[model samples]
Target: MFLDRVADNFLTQLVSEPTREGAPLDLLFTNREGLVSHVMVGGCLGKSDHEMIEFLIRGEVRRGVSRTATLDFQRADFGLFRSLVDRVPWEAVLKGKGVQESWTFFKKEILKAQEQAVPMCRKTSRKGRRLTWLNREIWLELRKKKRVYDLWKKGQATQEDYKDVMSNKRRAKGNLHPLLDVGGNIVTKDEEKAEVLNAFFASVFNSKTSCSQDTQPPELKDRDREQNEAPIMQGEMVTDLLHHLDTHESMGPDGIHSRVLRDLVEVLTKPLSIIYYRIIES
Candidate 1:
């Protein structure tokens, strides 16, 4: 038993009902007594073998709030967004400015208009969302599989019947199986499994190592190296590239969205080209 550390940590094990077969395999531990009660084994979820654990928290347990917000693209005002960027005179603003200065000014202008046009909403937690891919066919098939399993248990269905029902559950891709920890405890919950993997990776990561600090290449030996002209990039090329950017993709670390770029391609082409030109020239 896993009760040695449970007693040492002054925790109470509240689960008495078995989750599978006739053994109390699924354990529920709490630091406070009477905090959780009314523990029972509900039926399995989907085709999972282990039964679902049902319990209630006695008092108000305030969970931590996540302040992470994402852009509400459905209500974005692209008209105003483009208008704001169009009014900026890129040639005058970016004149006599270095590469970093040009990029910083461009980013500031874009972010300012983005805040006004694109509204932000709190990101919903994954546990509250349903899988979009789980359609009517998969649902009916799962029900049929459960019915077949019940019949098989009573010796009324053949093994091939159960196999036929299970063979159809492979339509969904990227399915994850239950993970077992080093201590042999089954981590069935998504959050618990994620934490276990994260902890393992963090334990093995070497943070003291550094890379590429002293690997700068030698200067070119050409006599005309200083006189060589930088490659020219036309505004049309930048506009074409921006138009081809997929709007469905997520924003990068710089907080600039692809949809906004595609929408304001004309306004951004000059500023982006100026920034790129300065970087190339340097």
Candidate 2:
């Protein structure tokens, strides 16, 4: 009656052997049609009474996409870049300008310099192969192993060769697994490990839900007001700013880097400062 309510089928057949004498010990029940692609029954583990059952399901899996753009820094012409910046008439063009106007002029000049010096090109993002650990020898070994695996799967190689290749592959993968700090706890399950990591990061960067009533509002004094109002930026100040730019950081969508600014600081400082002064006046 219960089986009628569910409308399921008995997947296992009755056998005359003693091991399968009574009811089907290993049973698989499915209500949905075409759900299970294939079923397999294998030997029992160690001294276990029940047999091992395995099945495959039909579906599609999606993979993540990796995309990136890179600048042709090797072919960059810094000398021409400096010459372009030096040729800009900073005093004549950017004088008596608004913030937007000054920005437009400076941006135009920078774009011209970039067009001449640092041209950008697109390419697929690469990893692992570039690392010192995964060298040419390792790559060759991996290729060879893969070829051997294919051959074995096609019944052209011995079982021992396939096992050896698999062992090497496992060893290589083991070396690449990221080591995470989980507060001295050993997490076996992936879900538990992810939860632990999420909790740790949440605690570190947690923000207050409400502002305290006791906190006072900020008041601008005379000096503070003067500081708030834009001041005339000097050539030396621009040069100093350029010198302090971080070289290790990546470029923006505009394909310009702080390293490029720093490299051309000597030529750009005076022109940039003039543009800044115009913005301050406006």
Per residue, candidate 1 scores C-alpha lDDT tens digits across 1-282 of 566877789998777888888788888889987889888887999988888999998998676564778788789998998898888998899888999888989999999999999999874555225354454566777798889999999999999988876776765555345566668576668898898888777766654332356767567785443433543556666776787786766689989999889988978988998888787788
How high is the CA lDDT of each candidate model?
Answer: 0.79, 0.66
Against the true structure, what is each candidate's TM-score? 0.45, 0.41
Any idea what lDDT model 1 has? 0.79
Query: What is candidate 2's lDDT per residue for 1-282, written digit by digit as tens?
Result: 965654555443322223343445666666455666567766678887766667776666754343544556778888888888888787678656767877777877887788888777754335522653564568898899889988988999999988987886687432112223456443445677577768777766665433458876568675333423443464555776788776657666655688788998897787677666655554
Best by lDDT: 1
Candidate whose TM-score is highest: 1
Alpha-carbon error at 185 in model 2, in Å? 62
Clashing pairs in 1: none
- How does candidate 2 fare on TM-score? 0.41
